[model samples]
Target: MVIVSVVGGISLLLLVFLWSIKRGQKTVRAFVFLSAVADGNSVESANELAKRIDLFAASELQKKAMIMVEMVFGGSQLKLISHARREGFDQ
Candidate 1:
């Protein structure tokens, strides 16, 4: 009984961890858009946005993939802007 309970608890925790990562990526994307607004984005609003996105995620793997995509590609708007600030792009 003890071993079974321990395994169940660990499994639940793992699920939560994956969900949080997916939710965090949604927060980042929302923040990027909110930053475009004249007023600054609030932490509360960002958290709410994350919750909505988490609920909308189709599956654990899909959620994880979305987060990875946002990090590597979707969030490059700022990186490109910063790179453009520098001098000519020559190798």
Candidate 2:
């Protein structure tokens, strides 16, 4: 019985770890998508991208993406806001 319980616990932990890795992959994909959109230099495109990002589950990747976006766009708040509203961000 003890061995069975131990194995069950380890299996649960393994499942949780795999789930976390999957979530991280999603975040990375979103970040890459954001980079591609930002490179286009179109506010409309960015806004559309923002809409897509909103569909993602909340995560730290969103904050990192914002920082990267600001740097890419020359750190201008006006430009960022104009292109992508910070409201309801997932990126």
Candidate 3:
């Protein structure tokens, strides 16, 4: 029973890890697509965005990517701008 529970817990954790990676990839792709649109270039595809996301998903910019993804998808830009102002990003 103990061994089974241990194995189940580990399996759950692994599933969660894989889910997070997939979610992060989706967020990164959305961010890239939005950025490309804002830059007036409509040539990017889903595969290209996926490749870019994979490249940065495990890098040091993961945190930044998460922040941007949240800002864009969560509609937190105004809040973030206010927070940044208070935190001195304006400086």
Q: Given candidate 1, what's the lDDT at residue 56?
A: 39
**Which candidate has the highest TM-score of all?**
3
RMSD of 1: 10.8
Query: lDDT of each structure?
Result: 0.46, 0.53, 0.53
**Candidate 3 deviant stretches above 4 angstroms:** 43-50, 55-61, 75-91
Q: Compared with the true structure, what per-residue lDDT tens digits does model 1 show for residues 3-91?
A: 99999999999999988765554444443333322144454453344345443343433444445346754754344223322322111
Error at 62, model 3, angstroms = 3.3
Q: Residue pairs in steric clash, candidate 2?
A: none
In model 2, where is the ten-residue run with the lowest total lDDT? 81-90
In the predicted model 3, the residue pairs found to clash are none
Residue 36 in candidate 2, Cα distance off native in Å: 0.8
lDDT of each residue in 2-87, candidate 3, tens digit only: 99999999999999998877655544555445445456554444335434656455354456656774855475444443443343
